[model samples]
Target: MPHDIISGDRHPEALPLAEKVREEERARIARDLHDELGAHLTGIKMALGLLRESLARAQGPEQPLEQARYAEQLIDEAGDAMHGIIDDLCPPIVEFGLAEALQWQSRMFTRQTGIVCRQRCGDGLDELGEFEVITLFRIVREALSNVAKYAHAENALITVERQGDVLTLRIEDDGRGFDLASAARNGSGLGNMRRRAQALQGTLQLDTVQGKGTTITVVAPVAR
Candidate 1:
């Protein structure tokens, strides 16, 4: 959502202010939905179930039974939708910790895309702050999304490690690489990835060779 992304600006150090703002807003909404809306939805579902049981016991009239059935169906649909929104807003990542989250994501990706994704994350990553944890999660998520959309590769790998004060993440795919210039011209995924890496006061390196593969490496400080 940054101007650089839309205008195809390729400055490495530029931050995606718009994208960051969007992410922050997303986090806030995730919290509110899960805490407020989610609770309400759950209560509604429970109430509907109780009402259905009451109707069954009382031998309610046919008209009321039909309406209750309709209402229960609606509540069930709404509950499912609410769950999806909450998951998107605040994934199951934080609950399981970063390393496990990455592993789960990788396995899900492999299952979904049939593109073998291997993950090797070192220990102690669960100790990072929330900001660092989510940032790394988003980085890896976006990287795999790109691979799914553009990589056309059969296998991909993700590596995470801690070295001194720095935390490093690498995503590599043996796909049909693209022209750097052309990719920069698209200015969406690549720009967003770079902006996120730079936002953490980290560095991102992209290596791609046509007909070979692409590797994205990001290194950021592990905030205490």
Candidate 2:
């Protein structure tokens, strides 16, 4: 009988191998959805646009004109939905690099809610791997999403820097602070943030005082 079988302890490498397989499958699916569905949505939008133009030039009846306009609107909506799906599947965060991604995200946040969001970065971050960069970006994004939804904040700041052998990500918002215990017991957002931080072998700290503001800081080892 093989010693590998019937052992109380499982193989040390099994879990990592499984995760690797899962990640590969996810990438494949994301690529297919981006290429196939994106092209299909583009074609539908173009066809609808041409039809609308043709109907306008032909001086069609009022009913057909209204129907054509409605169809075009639906097509536009579908296109927007497809883009949202693609973004969720595989965001361009990693592709654009961390600093650029952070800048873009902050700009969008500022534009959407009129909240002044600022970002700053330090040196030597280029050596960080894609996984580290994307994970940190996502952590910051989730923090901002929470701020916008619950913080009612007027100003926010995101700072990223490398210190010695560790990298730090900090997000601060000047909004109404919540009781950490209450939020943890009531919702899973904070819990999920902590889990993501732990996944990177990092530590997450939250600081908030009622009527003051909230700040989230995460520190992780740099993947060299």
lDDT of 2 by residue, 181-212 (tens): 56765666676566566656776788887788
Q: If scored against the real structure, what TM-score would every candidate get?
A: 0.76, 0.81
For this target, which candidate reaches the highest lDDT against the unseen true structure?
Answer: 1
lDDT of 1: 0.80
The true-versus-predicted C-alpha distance at residue 130 of model 2, in Å, is: 1.2
Question: Cα RMSD for candidate 2?
Answer: 8.2
* Candidate 2 clash pair list: none
lDDT (0-100) at residue 107 of candidate 2?
96
- Note the residue pairs that clash in candidate 1: none
Q: Write the per-residue lDDT of candidate 1 for residues 1-224, one digit (tens) a residue.
A: 11122122356454546556666788889888878987887888788788877887898687776777788899778878877887777676766777888999999999999999999999778788665666778889999998999989999999999977898999999998777766777747776677778777787788888788888889888765
